[model samples]
Target: MRQLIIRAMATGTVATLALGACSSGSSDGSAKGRTPYIGVILPDTTSSARWETQDHPALEAAFKAKGVKYDIQNAQGDKAQFQAIADHMLKEGVNVLMIVDLDAASGIAVLTKAKQEGVATIDYDRLTLGGHADYYVSFDNVDVGELQGQGLVQCLQGQTKPIVAEVNGSPTDNNATLFAQGYDSVLGQLYNNGTFVKGPNQSTDNWDNATAGKNFTKMLAQTPNIGGVLVANDGMAQAVIAVLKQHHLNGKVPVTGQDATVPGLQSVLDGDQCMTVFKDSVKEAQAGADLAVNLAKGQTASAANAMVADTVTGKLVQSVELTPEAIVKSNVQDVIAAGAVTKAEVCTAQFAAACAANGIK
Candidate 1:
């Protein structure tokens, strides 16, 4: 069983502080002398634009502000490239290594190697099921799914026995399972009581948008009555919306999404998508940087006040879990106010009127 240990703390932002005097050893757990260095490995760019547009810059800013030596790289969805990047980082002698694993097997290999080398490791954004990471940093993902579920339920109000289809993220990603767990808790009751009909559900490979489009297309073909969709993120939501447009059901069938990207927010404003969950990547990145900095300095990561049980290992891992917010058409401006997206990005000429109507200047 998976467990979550939570304690009361501010969830908005994590402060980045400069490093103090270095410890004896290098950041890579090497002989005493070299400065501490941190390494980060991102999963892919094709899954979502946030990997490059949001998380990369936020993490760079946080690390640069603290004068921390770090190398950040993306695997571009290739397992070999992911392993190669880790090998390079380890060879370069980083004190702390962080990763958003593409898959558990590859992640486990890298984390195990990092541990064998005596370097500290962190699972960032996406937790590796059984990886030997010292800490984990991410938003409460189950809450994200619950928000998507509740948002879908609200959007589906007044529909008679609506059929809901799920276009989930990659099957290999642990976050996808947690997300399904969350939304299913709410939607399952409706399915059991006959309040809603469950439609075709499938997981896309590596959260590919094109695969999501194909999966959703097949679902629509089999069950033309799919009343709502629970898409994992904005990229997949866009694909699902495109298919809905072909059937002239874009705005008619509500869709739930996450990551509050510019296009996702626009879809919500345009009434094409019902709602999206906003997770401030800056906050998540800052928390990760704080943890990495502490680990590099051979000190305890104070931000890891929470605990998450690794189901594969049955071990409780220290974590820093943040909160996520649900964003609908009515409150799209909140994402802009939080600086996750700019008004100009979401309020283009096509959506200008919608933005104005929603109180966005």
Candidate 2:
């Protein structure tokens, strides 16, 4: 498998990153009377809905408003496509490069090349291990996972020895690793104490929904008593819910998700899912855009919210880490108030009465 080969070949060492003479002149804004260019690459559309609906628009708006040159594209989960995009951008000599890496190894290759060309680079949303990026902007991924674990525990409080299945994000993603760390910290104790049954826990392939569906179905088959499901994001949770529905356990089982997406929110209202962790994409997108623009202008992203310690390289990278909030039926309206999702999208005819009761509008 590609995973095995990459893991075996991963160096985990900082690639030689000497930003040669390709530096963008001064830190004021324009470089040599020319507007700076920022190149951004998102991982894929299937990983999450926010990539297309939220992040892309916000990023474009930010750059357009600032009157900067930018080229943003989704790699569509293909490393070759990702490489081509990066090559094209580099050929145009972009001043700053930002990426949501599909895999750490491939991402490292891009960042390494950018560094060699003296282009400022940022690890956006997902951290690409062993890459020399100037900064990282994302939600506190470990905390995001912790919230999921805690939410599952709270959702099954009264149940005695309830079985819980975990549908985690792709193992190749570093953020997914942090999330697992957070949630497992909460779920592991209960499972060890026999307070809850830890059923099958599987990681989806590249955060794919179909893979999650198959994993969830397999878990349910092995442990039919599963009453709580901890899913990494809304997309995979939707797939799990469908399988649950087939088994007539949709409303009865508690499922956790993130991304406060329309479908995820509707599931909470319909009692088909427990809660979703709402990491506002606007905040992340705007923060990433701000950082990228600063870097493009030959400035550092030190104004970022925090300094992230890279476990692999043992170096601190400038970072902006936003908090992720847990969204349940009780406070799902808050997501609407924050404008992460429109009332029109979640308050459909089928969910009309529930939306009204929950003050979604």
Candidate 3:
């Protein structure tokens, strides 16, 4: 079955075509093959800002260096729109399909349909299970959750017996479960030890900020003396932080987040939020694009030493799992240096003094 998939992918009649043998000799670190046209399907722009601000540009730049043409489409938070975009790209004859898989069910449906037509799929940043996705590329998601939990613990170290609320990401997302496992692994130990009290834990839907805001408000109402919050990402963290601000508890209670978004970084610098996790998106985007080009050319992700264990599928799938770094006020510059966000964006007018104090200039 794998051989048949590879052979069909090599024909490149559906999406893009990989041009050569699977080798490490390509200048851009891709398999030795002709440049292949690539298609990228991102989930809603609202779910996470990183999709457009970071991943899109990084993927485009990486593909350009590898001599590949790329087409991109954003679903804009609509499942029907996501499916339409995938169908359109398939019709356009892209050799490979790389998607962020906002709604795994909808994304898998598209991927499964594409696979039947001899087009390969790469799950980008988010995994697409229950469907035959050709490859996966992103940070170790469980590690991301563990980082959030551990960071919150460290920030709450000197406090008295504290109450913690967990504002996790979309419930439909399998990664959300992985994140909770990581957080629970650490926090559960703390809870068992009686050092921390867990309270008001719930996962958001579609990672929507509005949903996160309402849930956060309810969680706060339920746990009046909450000491910290383990928010899954920057988006949900911002919503939670806004509610904290209303109660004058913004900087008082420590919060953990991921993606190191602009508001999250500013909150960290302003002492409103505690920290965030910064995934090396450039490396991830390049890895995904390289895999897409490789698969399009009939090469294997194994050629790049990228193999991943998919507990969801009970198989070792083709993938590259990158590491994530914790970003606090102390190391916000590291995220800037990583090009996750520019100094200009992070050090705006309101943040000028904070930037100068931190030597960000």
- TM-score-wise, the better of 1 and 2 is 1
The 10-residue segment with the lowest total lDDT in model 3:
1-10
Please write out the lDDT profile of model 3 over residues 245-278, one tens digit for every residue.
Answer: 9999999999888888888899889888898999
Task: Provide C-alpha RMSD values for all models, in order.
Answer: 3.1, 6.9, 6.2
Pick by TM-score: which candidate is best? Answer: 1
**Distance from true location, Cα of 293 in model 2, Å:** 1.0
User: What does candidate 2's lDDT look like per residue over 1-361, in tens digits?
Assistant: 0001111122222211213243433345443334589999998888788887778887898788777789999999999999999999999889888999998899999999999888889898887878878888788788899899999998898999998888999999988888888899899999999999888899998999999999889899989999799999999999999999999999889999999988899999999999999988777877777667666765433533456777678677766677789999989888888767788988999999999888776
Q: What is the per-residue lDDT of model 1 for residues 34-79, given as tens digits with 9 covering 90 to 100?
A: 5668999998888888888789999999898878789999999999
Give candidate 2 misplaced runs (Cα > 4 Å). Answer: 1-34
The 10-residue segment of model 1 with minimum total lDDT is 24-33
How does each model score on TM-score?
A: 0.93, 0.90, 0.89
Please count the clashing residue pairs in each candidate, in the order shown: 2, 0, 9
The C-alpha local distance difference test score for the whole of candidate 2 amounts to 0.83
Ranking by lDDT, best first? 1, 2, 3
- Estimate every model's Cα lDDT from 0 to 1: 0.87, 0.83, 0.79
Error of 3 at 81 (Å): 0.9
